[model samples]
Target: MPRPAIHQSCTKIVATVGPACDTPEQLAELIKAGVDVFRINTAHGKIADHEKKLKAIRAASEQVGSPAGVLLDLAGPKIRLGELKSEPLQLDIGAELTFIREGEPANDFEVTATYPKLIDELQPGNTVMLADGMVALVVESVSTDRATCRVTASGEVRSRQGINLPGVKLSVSSMQRNDIANAMWAAENGIDFISLSFVRSDEDVYSLKNVLKAHDCDAFVIAKIEKPEALEHLEEIVDAADGIMVARGDLGVEIDVAETPMAQKRIIQVCKEKVKPVIVATQMLESMHHNSTPTRAEASDVANAILDGADACMLSGETAVGDHPIKAVEVMSRIMRVTERNLIHEINHSVSHCVHPITTAVTNAAISIAEAIDASMIIIATRSGGTAWVKSKSRSSIPTLGVSDCPATLRRIQLFWGIRPVGIEKMASPAEIRAKISQWGKENGQLKKGDRIVFVTGSGVVEKAHNAVVVHSVE
Candidate 1:
């Protein structure tokens, strides 16, 4: 039997899959280096391509003897440019540009959009950001089928780059036809997590959940907090979704670039209070796409995210289509491990007023006990993985194990900070748990004769809520 890949760091790393590390061998290298979760960006690839990546991930997981969660990131109703007549068309300052609807006659200076109704949505003076905010255009005139604009910020524009209309209310549905199809495919493919991009409200999260429910898929729904509307309804959206992702790419474009740092901190703090796993994503190691190492500022950005209470920090281009995919994961893991060393006395989660009071109390007590005894490890026996989540939020420095029988639950908790998902027989009695963990501990060399272990479970409770904490000595 292969041993589970147990990581020492509390914060997790999520790496996006791309041509750089799509092979099973490359993925296995990433898994061994330290990747808690793999993100499949549905925006750039076909369903069949993603299917191949999924298969490679599964094979790599087995080869590495570790479990990694899969995140199916749905490309929501994104406004983007269509094929450009000239590749890498440079738009200088004060240049005139015309954005036309699909199938509309376009000249060399004119462009068409993937959304046919894009021209209709445009009005005079509306700001249009393209190529991830590198190029900016202000609507000068709106004619039938075309919106003539003047380029305020000039940069090279490419085919299929995203277009952002900041502050302009879009009529597009949050859940588009492609999103639904992708969600269906994700559910059918057993993706552990499905993230809805550009989530505007709790209803958007619920809508994705409903789709999964209809398909009998229990994959966790992650709401990507990118739009301004999502921030307006942050609390409700956090409470609605299974998890949250601070998607800072489009978010930076949608909101002021100056506000994104504070916004990222705010989102992580909210998830911490709400006890939902939050991932900080986008350009954490942007320069690493070409360079062998991350810039100093990028390293601090990643470390600060962990310090800000983010459960995980994600790698986009650094691991996807990068020159150093494995190196990026290794560097990220190293940063997390180093940053965590300073969080030994981090604040315990104060969520008594929120949901799962009983489970929260038990996990809280378990953390205190572990700290008091300087225990070697904390063991959270969970059924649906809620107890583990609570313990994870406590942010205890002690190494912890989330033991669950359900395969789905085990995979889902991979995103949780500080708590490693370990498969057990089932939620068992304290004695049974002790025996199993004792065997595991010794095999993994995590426990010895005098070592102490803290266990949190719901053995006495008839309901699913955890209500017990026990301390045991390895004898």
Candidate 2:
């Protein structure tokens, strides 16, 4: 039997690139520690900073001999406060504050918001949350010029802090001006995935997709499920986007904090049923940002996400601004490995529900054959990476290798669960594929003469369709 080239765990790890791990050497270390995808957040940094980070990621990926995918996260329409009269404004319980429009005249107790129309949307008794729900206020009165809110939860707030209205229906476009510009930049730079923040509906996903299409970019658009509306339209959003991310940060604030766990499970279940790759993100190992080791509860969170059938787990501040970025990736990989060990038996029972009927049948049969024969490995030759994605959805315990001639396809499949993208130029024939696999396996000490390998491929017989499965033995 051949050992897995990149990893043994089925669940993938996505780490954000930030000041903590900006250089090529640091990024390479994280990749070597088991980071499958690097997320570049466009919220904090400038375009030039992100460009440099992209170059560093490519260099690091080449250094590690792995095709790591890049996820460019766009900052969607985020409602925030403007400059405050007092920096780090402290609001006391029962304090009355006025929220005026951006250009409205205001006194010490009156505040202005970045969204000029915020005052128009506020109603009496609406709950307003600020600084990621640290401060809370209940709307008391609304006039033409300003809305008065009584502080329900007292906390410190700074300029430009986010404001979340739980159930308020505000007239905000899904894709803001900054998001459109960032999406265009991502398209031009060949980002493997583009994640839109605060996606509220399938239309929101389509909005970003339309921009990408106009630019002739095929990068997968990932819809971030952060708002309560997104949960209501979850099915349609999942169907519309290429992937889903359980963005728990704002989601927890938008909905009740207590409902986040169940919501996370529901999102994962929906993605699994729809055969879309879902990433469980936000604070899986938050404590690891400062500590070298993660707390037991954090480890359990990561484990439970894997147990919930998430294709990938993401680290935000843990890897982006954490002091221990490399160690965070290592710890996350360890948790995934242990969690997957317990699911090996259950994994073989997974059935893929793919849109393509023939590809689904071929992938399912290939998994059954591999498990029946106890094959050393499963190799999938894919064109658009759909075949390998179907195989990955089946959750086969056997180590699977995804071979693609297209460079973009190879990079894109890096995020698929249980599929390791292997670089091979042309695997057009069975004899050639077998020889290449046997030679590479032997060189890597992954296989010997008697080991068996299963090859599933479309072979360009039909465009973007997989229709064949061949079982081969190592020579």
The TM-scores of all predictions, comma-separated, are 0.95, 0.95
Worst 10 residues of 2 by lDDT: 345-354
User: How many clashing residue pairs are found in candidate 2?
Assistant: 1
Residue 415, model 2: lDDT of 90
The residue-level lDDT of candidate 1 at 363 comes to 79
As a TM-score, model 2 comes out at: 0.95
Candidate 1 per-residue lDDT, tens place, 1-475, comes to 2455555567888999998999999999998888989999999878898899999999998888677899999999988888888888999989999987766445668888888788788889999999999899999999887799999999999888999998887778889888899999998988999999999989889999999999999898999999999999999999998889999999999999999999999998888777788999999999999999889999999999999999999999889899999999899899999998887565555662333767777677778889988999888777777778777877778888887777777778789888787776644566887887888778778778878999888433224543777888887
Candidate 2 structure quality by residue, lDDT tens digits, 1-475: 2223455467998999999999999999998899989999988878898899999999998888888899999988888888888787899999998998656445667788888888889999999999999999999999998899999999999888999999998789988888899899999999999999999889989999999999999999999999999999999999999999999999999999999999999999988877899999998999988999999999999999998889999999998899999999999999999898877533323333434667767778888999999999998877788888888887778988888777788889889999998766554565676688889888888888989999888446335543788889888
Deviation of model 1 at 169, angstroms: 0.5
Candidate 1 has what TM-score?
A: 0.95
Give the residue spans of candidate 2 off by over 4 A.
Answer: 1-4, 103-108, 344-355, 459-466
CA-lDDT, candidates in order: 0.85, 0.87
Residue 37 in candidate 2 has what lDDT? 92
